[model samples]
Target: MRDKLLMAYRSIRERRTRSILTVLGIAVGIAAIVSLMSVGYGMEEAITGELTGYADFIGVFPAKITGTTYVELGSFTDRDLKDVQRIGGIKEFSAMTFDSAEVEYRNKRVPIFFISGDTKELESMYVEPVGLKEGRWLRENDYKGCVIGDRVANDYFDEVVHVNDKLIINGEKFIVVGVFEKASTLYASDIDPYIFLTLRATKEALQTDEINYIMVRVYDIEEAEEIAEEIKEAINDNHGLDDFANAMTMGSMIEMMGDVFNIIRGVLVGIAAIALVVASIGIMNTMLMSVMERTHEIGVMKAIGAKSSDVLSLFLLESSMVSLVGGVVGCVLGAVAAKVISLGAGTALGIEFGAVVKPEVLLGGMVVAMVVGVLAGFYPARKASRMSPVEAVRHE
Candidate 1:
């Protein structure tokens, strides 16, 4: 084994320029696979992580009206809420109403979103208590209190708002109680430029007794789909239409997102495979050229006691060694490329992206390189082993 490897090493050393170029060809393919796949993996991880809180939660949206052009799904009535509350498997739930309004702090006015909900139920649906950048969350008894999002406090106005500051919304004055941390999502900006108020306060200000949507937390995540169906049926029966309301579970949404990423990963890997095919062809051509150039040397070896197997092993080993080096260099380059690209893109988009370099991905790149080497070298190695000693010597 040592002798075979030594022979291979010497052969490669004698053709340094050709060997280096061949290695670069393989390296380019492997690097592309590693870098592109890493980015896909990273995006999947980021989105999935952000959605963890919604794993067991269900969303209820009003159904669209079929016949009416100006009027569609009406707001949730008192009866609708009462019916949904009676559904089994519901651990907790909260109603939400949203409106666009201008908030005045001192003499400065800024337009912002107003989300109204039950304070405690809001905390329960998110699983974890609201994460605060400063101050505290709203309390049930604090009807005059409000919580602003991170962007509202820092970015919405000329002066930054702080806890305990007084603000007027639609002629109603309230005190700022807390600020929520920025929320992350894949295709959307952070959820940090809004205001949160209690259900009663929002209702009084909006002059509406209807709820826009309901956020439901189920007892078990595994039963989320079943619970959603039950909720849909219950709401539809109350409204006398199957499409009066729609229920969606977070788990199903996550699975759909997983399918999207799977397709993306396959397409990206396919593109990388093209580069690998080109590299494989380069290896085959280089090996065949080496055989033609060393025809007489092969004949001399065959004229002696060296068997055809020995000559085949020598050539195969040389090709494998070149691929191995390329694979290692490619792994390093790919990882660096992923990091640099992630950083640049993350900054420009105001999003967090981390390049994921999984162990299996690295190992797969090496295995592919090695397999490509053997396959690429096989025909050329066979030609060298089959050379007749007298004919090869006479030809050159």
Candidate 2:
């Protein structure tokens, strides 16, 4: 048995190119599934963490759920904002509006997407209060005053866009009150414009009383998600609004992303199953070909008193060793591919998955590869064991 197994190993090693190609093919499929899922999960986590850093951020939309960036067609009557302020369990809240316009300075013009809204009770809850680069932060009852993005400052408004600098917007004039430190994380809210202003001013300039959205800071920050659920039920009961249940808490979103990743993991595992099956078939074919070509040698061993069980064990051992080597090679290749994708594409695309080869994914891939190798060897090993010595010797 030992001699036969060693012979099988030697024969496969002699054809290293074919064996390596088969393993590489299987590795390619496994790596793709593993890498894509890992990155997706990572991105979701990063965004969730960014969301949670806010003290008590919550968003409310009339037709859509909260935490969504979609803006539906509706005017947020001043009355609606007042009614929301009266809701129970609400520590504080703010109303915000949005618009896009071209900002023109003395000789240059640049487009800026800006959020215009009123100053209200909940500045801390809704915004993290950006660092003021120029004059000062927004003041109470400050109108015709706007904050510029730092990027806007350097490029459009010359070297210094000071507090008193005039900004032309859609031919309307606004005094630059302050500049924000560079913005971070696009996941903040629906308002992604280059300027921030009072809600009343936004209404007057944009010609709409409707705010783009509203944010509510819950009394207990930890219960934000739970309270958001409660808020949904209450709104449904009172407003007779159905499917307007899009309120989301940062914690709840993280939890929901977790569930989604689990489902995605299951799908990736399913794809791995198919790939393993294919690789297993290749191993089986290699083993059977080895059996056919070595039949005469097998017959010689049997005639020399090699038992059928001995013959079977030897063939099985040969295939197992071959599979084991394939598994190791596949694991290395898959990890490399995953890392390359995570670092190369991750950085280039700015998706920023921390690192590639997640421990769970690596362990799972190795286990699947070994199982595929063993299963592929089984039937061919059995066939080699049952051959008749006399017939095999006479055949060729």
Candidate 3:
């Protein structure tokens, strides 16, 4: 065993540049798999945080709108909010109406997702955002006062409105009272412009009583799902209902995020996986070439009381050593690359995502490399074992 290892080591050392190149090729692939996966996982984390920031604001998408495209989904009704609040054990709830809108401040016009919420749920649910670069947040009964996110307020409205001025949304004037601090998507970390208003005012502006989402908070966080179910049933039974609204507790939304993020992480990892497969191909090629070059040596070793199994073990050991070393190099390189990618993209996205190669990914890479080495060496090892000593020695 020692002799085989020594021989394997010597062979690789003799062809220093070739061995290094071969290992490096595999390292590049390994690094990609490890680093990209880590980054993907980090992105998923960032997005989850961004989406769930409003702990109490349960998203209320129109429940499986019958026979409609994602683009054609209908809005929820105000009665839907009333129905949900009517359920027993349900404490408080609020509704939001959203539309793509253009806000005009003097000569400047900016487009954003027009979102409106009534009551203190905007702040109480943390939907108002935590940080404000300037001014205060939306106050109840300050009917005309509205708050805009940092990006929207500064870049667009700041020029016209100071603290107590009005801006126009679809020709309807609204007072710019407060500005929110910089906020990222706690769920996606993707920047989106969300402009808020009073539900009543927003409904009037849109010329309808329709709401796009309803946020519900129940007694005891654990009862969120049960309360949501009861709400759903109540909506179905409501006699005056035209199209029923969908109710969701926070738990269901969070659970949906888990499945969603897992798929995203898997996709990112899969892209990197293709690169690793190419590296494995390179490993296999190198092993086959090594076998061909050492035909005479293999024959001589076999003639000198070395069994076919010994010949197989020697080549397998060589491939394993090469891949093992390459795997380590790849892991380190990949982690550094992930960090660089994270810093460049994550920062731009306003997310402080850190690149961390999970232990499982690292270990998995090593195990895969070793297995690939052994598998790649199989045919060559068998070929070396079957050669006749006389035929090999006389050939070259």
Candidate 4:
């Protein structure tokens, strides 16, 4: 076996150019599969982590009312909150209203998405306090102060708005109590380009009592699905219609994201596999050429009482070795490619893209490459083993 491997290695070294090109072809395919699949798995974990960070959290939104646009649809009411509070397994609930306004700072004005809610309740729902770029979050009793998003404080104004700077919004002056550090997430949420104010303050400014949405935290995350259903039914029953409101749980959102990625990964892997098929054909062609070139060598081995199986194994080993080396190189290239992609995307979009390569994915890629090599070399190896010693010796 050692002698056969050495002979195989020597043959590859003899035809260095052809061997290198063929290995590169296989490497391209394996690299595509590895990088794409790694990014897919990494995205799944990143998104799921963000969603579950606010454990057992559910968002309740006003549903389609059939005859009105989404903007004109009925908003969450005080009664809905009362009903949801009565539901079992719910730990706490908070009412929030979302609005957009042109915020004016001295000579500059910028539009911002703002949330009006209980400061204490918002704090409880979040994993941690809004990391401040400047000052601090809203105190429970504060009514005229607001915390600004990172963009609002840093980029939105003509000058950087500092802590204690007063901003005018909707003809109302609000002191900048804090500034969010920066927004980073795959999905757009209240974190980016948003301002937070006390519920009473916004309610007074808007001159309306309607709530835009509600967030509920459940005691047990495992029972979130059932709790969500109960909340939805309760709201619908109170309004006397199924389409009046919609409830979404963290688990369902995560599962939906998982399903979407699974489809994407499947399609990307299929495309990569096509490249592998092309590489497999290249391997077969190379093996056939090698068999023809070494016809006399094969004949001599057979004449010296070497079995056909021995000849076949030698050829198979050579092809498999080529693919194995390609697989290793491909993995390195794939990891570097994944990292480059992640960095570029994160810088451009401000979303975290962690490229994760699992142990199974690495092992699976190499194993698949070896299997393809063995199959590609089979016919050529068989033909070489079956050549007649007399004919092969007489031929040029």
Query: By TM-score, who's the top model here?
Result: 3
Which residue window of length 10 is worst by lDDT in model 1? Answer: 63-72
- Judge candidate 2 at residue 394 and give its lDDT: 72
Candidate 1 residue lDDT tens string, 1-396: 998898888989899999999999999999999988898888888777667766878988785533223234877778888888998889988888866787888788877887778888765533143377778888877778888877888887778889998888877899998877665445334447778888877777656556778889999998999989888888888888878787778777677678888999999999999999999999999999999999999999988867999889889998899899889988888888888877777776667878898989989999999999999999999999999988877767
Candidate 2, residue 38: the lDDT equals 66
Model 3 collision count: 10
Report clash pairs, candidate 1.
Answer: none
In model 4, where is the ten-residue run with the lowest total lDDT?
A: 64-73
lDDT of 4: 0.82
Report every candidate's CA lDDT.
0.82, 0.67, 0.70, 0.82
Q: Which residues of candidate 2, in runs, are more than 4 Å off? A: 1-8, 54-56, 65-75, 99-113, 117-142, 145-168, 175-194, 233-240, 243-245, 259-278
- lDDT by residue (tens digit), candidate 2, 27-89: 655565566656555656656666667647566666564343564645455655666676667
Clash pairs (backbone) in predicted model 3:
47-187, 47-188, 49-186, 50-185, 50-186, 50-187, 51-186, 51-187, 131-181, 132-181
C-alpha lDDT of residue 339 in model 1: 81
lDDT of 3 by residue, 357-378 (tens): 6899889877777776677667
Kindly list the per-residue Cα lDDT of model 4 for residues 247-276, writing each as its tens digit: 878787787778888998999899989999
For lDDT, candidate 1 versus 3, the one ahead is: 1
Model 3, CA-based lDDT? 0.70
